[model samples]
Target chain A: MWDYSETVKEHFFNPRNAGAVADANAIGEVGSLSCGDALRLTLKVDPATDTIQAAGFQTFGCGSAIASSSALTELIKGMTLDQALHVSNQDIADFLEGLPPEKMHCSVMGREALQAAVANYRGEVWQDDHEEGALVCKCFAVDAVLIEETIRANGLSSVEAVTHYTKAGGGCSACHEGIEEILTRVLAEQGKTFDPAAAPPPADKSGSAGARLGTLARIRRIEHAIEAIRPNLQRDHGDVELVDIDGKNVFVNMTGACAGCQMATTTLEGIQQRIVEDLGEFVRVLPAQAMPQTTNNQ
Target chain B: MTQAPAGIYLDNNATTMVAPEVVEAMLPYFTEQFGNPSSMHQFGDRVGRALKTARQQVQALLGAALDSEIVFTSCGTESDATAILSALKAQPERREIITTVVEHPAVLSLCEHLEKEGYTVHYLRVDRKGRLDMQQYLDALSSKVAIVSVMWANNETGTLFPVEEMAELARSAGVMFHTDAVQVVGKIPIDLKRSAIDMLSLSGHKLHAPKGIGVLYLRRGTRFRPLLRGGHQERGRRAGTENSASIVALGKACELALAHMDAEKTQVRMLRDRLERGILAQVPNAFVTGDPSNRLPNTCNIAFEYIEGEAILLLLNKAGIAASSGSACTSGSLEPSHVMRAMDIPFTAAHGTTRFSLSRYNTVADIDRVIAAVPPIVAQLRRLSPYWDASAGAPLAEPETAFQPAYA
Candidate 1:
């Protein structure tokens, strides 16, 4: 399940300024039904004062997307067109506390939709739809120009990050090489080196994002695994005690029948499997005797 | 330390709640019985005996002739990888594979990886009803095809494939065949003894067992190679120490499934039908996906027009209803489900598809709550949808079926 922020859930459940502005003159739309997410932003602008009077939005997307759209409307309601134009996708994200990296595209869509709405009010052509880059991701119909622009804007360095920002290379994986080339070119222009390994390859969202799990969550996961495994050891009149975690290696003390058991290696491996498989951590289960210096270390 | 209680869970196809019986059966292994089944000591002997019984239980569930046919693995993906890779290794002379376009990621991702390694894979497409084109399957089978790995039932649509017929054809073509029967094993009965399927994969979690336990049923005398080659476990068919607790849980889960199979076909089906009928009646422009006559009794996939699936699911979540979506946004992908795409389901309808999969644990009140919850959720999302208006009557699907090219 997505760890949607409470504010996001709040805005999604009880959105502010939903539906169209009753007397709105300008409307902007982004995304297609085929894209699986779209937003239409309507604004009621004051012609004489040029200050924004009201903003409303209708969104067709996930909870975060709806929340982002709602946040976009709320933020731009009292701001001038120029000020609203300055509201970035990150600002919308910050407004909602945060969005999952994979769902950053939702905020991007909100920003684009807002910009398009502002441009429509000025009777100016929308720049977002006028880009002429070749299609980079056939799955999402994302274009090369957009991918390169998003990479430069977000300072993205990896295909996975590019996917988060631009929805490029998120499907079929046929466009990952293209995304990598774009990332390399953009990062080189900014004089920053692009290391593919720095952000890992494209994986399912949970595995890729789990790389950032906090130490508390990580230890809790270890405890949960041990809790599941300790029952058997306890039933056998044995137990495994967690001693210390030194980076990737976890030290544990085996007591009772497990201390001198012939299959202690196998039992440790079993515990390791439980921790490493779904927990998305690079961890090793080692005997406390394997590393005796942890007690003396800070 | 506490939060909202888990709501009415309808995402059983994604993963079922582990049965209490399965939990009770496996708990002893975690505490007092954590012995390596391979040990020569009394502890090992006792574990090994329990493991043998678990194997027999799984064998009985599938109605297989011998218990030795079942090889335990970590999950359905591992079993799938093992079966497909083994087929290729055992017949290195053959470099081609045939599978459906709508297989679970376990099979589809592996096939896509194999394609990068210069192996040819024929991804057969399904019709509008999520039925595979038999002619395509027959045409794909040849001397060069090492294996035909089609899922017995699609996870998204719950459409059953003609695996028995496909397996027979592959056998006559001198090719191995495997089926990812993860969704079919417990929802429906399987008599492997009467079929020619060379290998089959089933996940424990889908059938009320905990995750991380699965079985690959390789027909006796079939040439095979181990995916994890190290230990003498699983008769050397798979390597690594046995996940004894989960393996035992899978055994008890299978036993319970065998006992409840009839109820799944009858009572569960009735609940699913009522839920479907109720929602369709209350909601406008809603259409059920997949074949009506032939599908898993527990699955009901409905598309609410003019609204996105994730938005509907979010509203349902607020109503304490748990369901899954085929929408691209829900999957963290750019395209909707490959199953929906392959079936030429239009983009307008495809992105709105929501799946409700039940288990025997569900009750009439659970269905009633869902039926009561969904129409309002759909109405709420449709009200928020840009394309939807209160006065609008219905919506039409996009005409283009060319985006996801059909298997020609």
Candidate 2:
């Protein structure tokens, strides 16, 4: 089961604006029954002030889609047309506390319908169609621009947040590394940098010169060498992620089908040791578990 | 979850409980009359007579002219494979097969594998209610078509297909026709002699007999090949040890079906209708799938648009009410059912599709329990959704019409 947030669950169960509108200003219908979910959103707009006076919806969908419509109605009621138009899918998700990463698209659908409804009210087309952009998640039809924009707007601090916003790396997970790279590039473009060196140093480092390769220059050298070896490991049905470096011990996390395989220890001993040796004898390569559980958990 | 005093057996479509009469008829086979039907001894000859009597009972139920046409197999899937493979083998020159989109996986997957092996396979589309398009089916049938396979009734939606007409069309084109009548047998009348159907398959479990027993009826003079190759247990058509006990049980079950056909048609239909109407009326946005006019008297496929079928099934199981989902086979994938997709049913509604197949054991009270329990569960799942806001129930004005030309 998808780990739906309490707020999402609350809105789903007790949806605010369910049913059809009797006399509404503009209505929008998005998605199809064949597509697995459909929504019929009706709005009663105040023509004098151009504000949404009332909203009602009749959705033929799952709990998430219904809740998304319900949350959308609640967000738009009493708000001006412009305010309602700016009510992003992210805002809807946040308003509902949080939604399952996969069902985030349902919230996005709600937002799309709202924009289309508002456009209908203005008697104009809402043309945000940048179809030529690179596809971010093909399964959900999400694009790269949308993912980057969502990340920037939401202050997403982790890969999980990016998943919640754009639904990237959720399906197939073949694009997880690409999503991570895009996220990192987006963060860099925004002048935000993540430096592992900024973390507090470990306290129990009382060892000889062989174990005391803690100089910043040595650390940078090891980082460069590990980066060079990363691609080769990835090609051999494995991935190497930096856990944390404490003194001469360079910690890396191996993943994929290799994570818990019988060959994992051999990989660490032979493959990882050779890479570490290339960096210098001072550097000791270790698995992620070599560090204390509490220290690594962070 | 309310626990019943005894374990409620609600998955009747999967298998059914053996009626008392069927069990009594099989008692002698398990003990007193344990003899090989093929043996030359007097005891074996008596067992052979019993087998002949059973064959006649099966023939009478199916409305077939002769008992020789009915060839007993080990199971439904095996019978289905036998029918399709036999058609392909007999007409080796014709490498094309045509079937409907809503056929059970037993047929659909086999056709798919055949396509991978350089054979052309056409899957005719079905409407939203799971009805096949006859014109499209007829168009797909050609001289190159080896067989045209279609199900008599859909297991999920209970929608009846025009099998007789389809069979006639296939026969006119000199192609074989097969129907997996597993869901329809004993529930509806089937006249094999009157229809142009060349082969038909039926399973024992669906009609309250033990599993591992099935029957395939091949029309006389129809070109065919046996699927199995070993000792000739089923007249060299199916080889291996005979499931004598289960076959006896199935024969008795067929007898009971023939005796109780009239009452089953009326009573089960009434219970099914009541269940369908009650659920639709009580729940918001709930609707039934399949042709309302032509359907199984004891089956209803409903979509309570929003809640997942697994959640509903779990809740129903807790309440001692059994049900199945159209998306049950594709569970964990979160994809809407392939059947619903082919029919153009919306994905949101497709995930919510549930099937309730009734039997003689079900009562009006059972339907009432289902009607009472399902709405609340739908409401509960809807509440957890971010899409619905319960507090915003105030009425809104109707939107002005923005009518576009219907053709455009």
Candidate DockQ scores, in order: 0.21, 0.09
- In model 2, the Cα lDDT at residue B273 comes to 88
My TM-score estimates for the predictions, one after another, are 0.77, 0.62
Candidate closest to the true structure, highest TM-score: 1
Please identify model 1 stretches exceeding 4 Å from their true place. Answer: A129-298, B1-6, B391-408
> What does candidate 2's lDDT look like per residue over A121-191, in tens digits?
88977554422234556454456667777778866545555564455655566666567767677778879
Q: List model 2 lDDT by residue over B275-327, tens digit each.
A: 88988887877788888789888788898765567556655665666677864
RMSD of each: 15.2, 11.9
**Model 1 over residues B91-196: C-alpha lDDT tens digits?**
9999999998899999998999899789999999888999888888888889999999999988887888889988898999988989999999989999999999
Q: Which lDDT value does model 2 have at B80?
A: 94
Q: How does each model score on lDDT?
A: 0.83, 0.73
Clashes of each: 8, 44
Per-model chain A TM? 0.48, 0.48
Clashes of 2: 44
